[model samples]
Target: MSAPDLLSFAKAVSSGAIRVVDLTQTLSPEFPIIALPPEFGQCAPFRLEEISRYDERGPAWYWNNFTVGEHTGTHFDAPIHWVSGKDLPNNAVDTIAPEKFIAPVCVIDCSADSTADPDFLLTVERIESWEKQHGRIEAGSWVFLRTDWSKRDYKAYANLKEDGAHTPGPAAEAVKWLVEERDVLGFGTETIGTDAGQAHLFNPPFPAHFFMHGKGRYGLQCLTNLDQLPAKGAVVVAAPLKIKQGSGSPLRVLALIASK
Candidate 1:
């Protein structure tokens, strides 16, 4: 029951040859949220207004109305998000190709570095070493950075202080290489962003977002469950909420790992 295409992948889910991994953080008010500076329009945190918890608002059902930023929690970022991809046609979430949402993935482990320094940046050399062990990262594949960063608590996850949040992510050059060379489908991380927290210091600033999206590539932030995947061969299924003309959207990021 091997999947030759997307439809086969869907069918594999039913037979259990391919398993679904919930690569998302539970969205709730308690989830440690990303903090953006004032002045710029801020991305809202995941907050739910209990429409009914089965006690008051509605007795028959238990549900809530939530307002969250497009990039909140486990989310997807479309090209039109930044000013770079602004003029590109079909740049927004709704306009992205549905097929782009599914692709194979390669996990680059950097747990030791992330543990030592919260602001570690993944370099191109690191990615190369990963390839040496796991075989080449195929074109149109996802390069997920496994930092084991999701194990941290709120205060540590954000690690914000007088300066800003500290987290591990792609170096500017690393992202450029991934796009131009490997031609990865996108990048994913357990941290709050695809770019390192101090990415503003990089020339062009936030190069991961700049080039990745400017080229119509995608991004996944606040991811989890990378440990469950092999170094390669797993396919990612990250479907954003079909918001009209939206820049990005919180999504359920699932990984399909084929069992031998």
Candidate 2:
């Protein structure tokens, strides 16, 4: 964009002609984290310790020390998070180009289906149906599956069961199609993961991670307020922390949309 175009955008933002939506869920100990079976390594939940609260430690200032897993709450997943993209260059969070952090987004609303069946898996047919109405998903755009999962209570959000959590996600074929055909920059979800809870049963399990990361694409999870975004036109700003060789990290995701 030219300097004039950039200046107009800045002016629009200041003049309330554009709106900004926060897509990140608040990071707290109460927020649910992805659960793994006993045999597998686990992710740590957000934890904080008060270093000073204007007491003896600090006379007039308050601060804290906190610890959290790389993929804790409202996180970004780099290609290196999975073995499929382990060898890919610039696959880690810090190495990814900064320009990649901002891109147009396509929000696919599957709330009705998700509400009807928690384990509903998005199919290519569904995507095509969406495209028929909204237009084709452009390359290098973020495709966010809006399941309204972020509105559930902590336990209900996780929806853990004897077998596993029963959450909605894209089918393997759908994921493959998104990566190979559409060439999306990444996938986003309001659920705990980019894959369905029962995705383990599918061939090449966790296909979203498999195909997306395998192609040096990205993933965002535990996102909220996806319903606030339009099916097209909105741009997402999802820049993760610059952790050295990090697989993934919690991030504050934001969306910019035109007000009028």
Candidate 3:
């Protein structure tokens, strides 16, 4: 089969045959960051400093300087983020191939399960069930876990308790299966981190980070608008900032979906 025509694809999007859905969460001071134990260094929240306004330093144009942690808000995680992948070449965002920025996606909706239990874990059995109906997940495609957690308000979104955060994510075995069995491009979540909030209790701890990154796969966190996309046939564009030796970076994720 012939490859898709780039110009024609762009025209389709412009002509409304294809709809683009923004999957990124808005970056703001209120957007919650992952909370680590007190002994660990904490990621900074989004902050902005007014460099100029229409009436100020630059009358012709206005701009502001922003400061934020690489992993703040909706972000992309590179392989280097975890010590398991630290020694791998091209593990950092800047070193990753640009070709990886775009890929096909398979969204597994677990909203009902997550709603029933915030600590819900996406097991291999659940993934198999999804595949049975939607067809097998393709190789080199991103596997997104849609929990509808992005729809919560600030307080509920974080869902932090005295013990820690309460959120849903894939089980350790699921992550390994997706990477080894499916050869997926990556794993994504609508939560602050790719791993479940209580994943620390897992054998390797933060298994998503451990297995995914360790094997040169990627991760996307704090995404939104998964409800706008189909379970399959959606292509995700997740381009992170080219930060040198950086573990991760906030990104503007967009999904291209064909309109029936």
Against the unseen true structure, what C-alpha lDDT does each candidate score?
0.87, 0.96, 0.95
Candidate 2 ranges beyond 4 A from true positions: none
The numbered model that scores best in lDDT is 2
RMSD of each: 2.2, 0.7, 1.3
Best by TM-score: 2
Q: Is candidate 2 or candidate 3 better by TM-score?
A: 2
lDDT preference between candidates 2 and 3, better one:
2
> Taking the tens digit of each residue's C-alpha lDDT, what string does model 1 give over 3-26?
478678668888998888899999
lDDT of 2 by residue, 1-260 (tens): 99999999989888879888999999889999998989999999999999999999999999989999999999999999999999999999999999999999999999999999999999999999999999999999999999999999999999999999999999999999999999999999999999999998898989999999999999999999998999999999999999999999999999999987
> Candidate 3's error at 213, in angstroms?
0.3
**Candidate 2: worst-modelled 10 consecutive residues by lDDT:** 10-19
Can you write out model 3's per-residue Cα lDDT over 19-124, one digit (the tens) per residue?
9999999888999899899999999999999888887599987898999999999999999999999999999999999999999999999999999999999999
> Who is ahead in TM-score, 1 or 3?
3
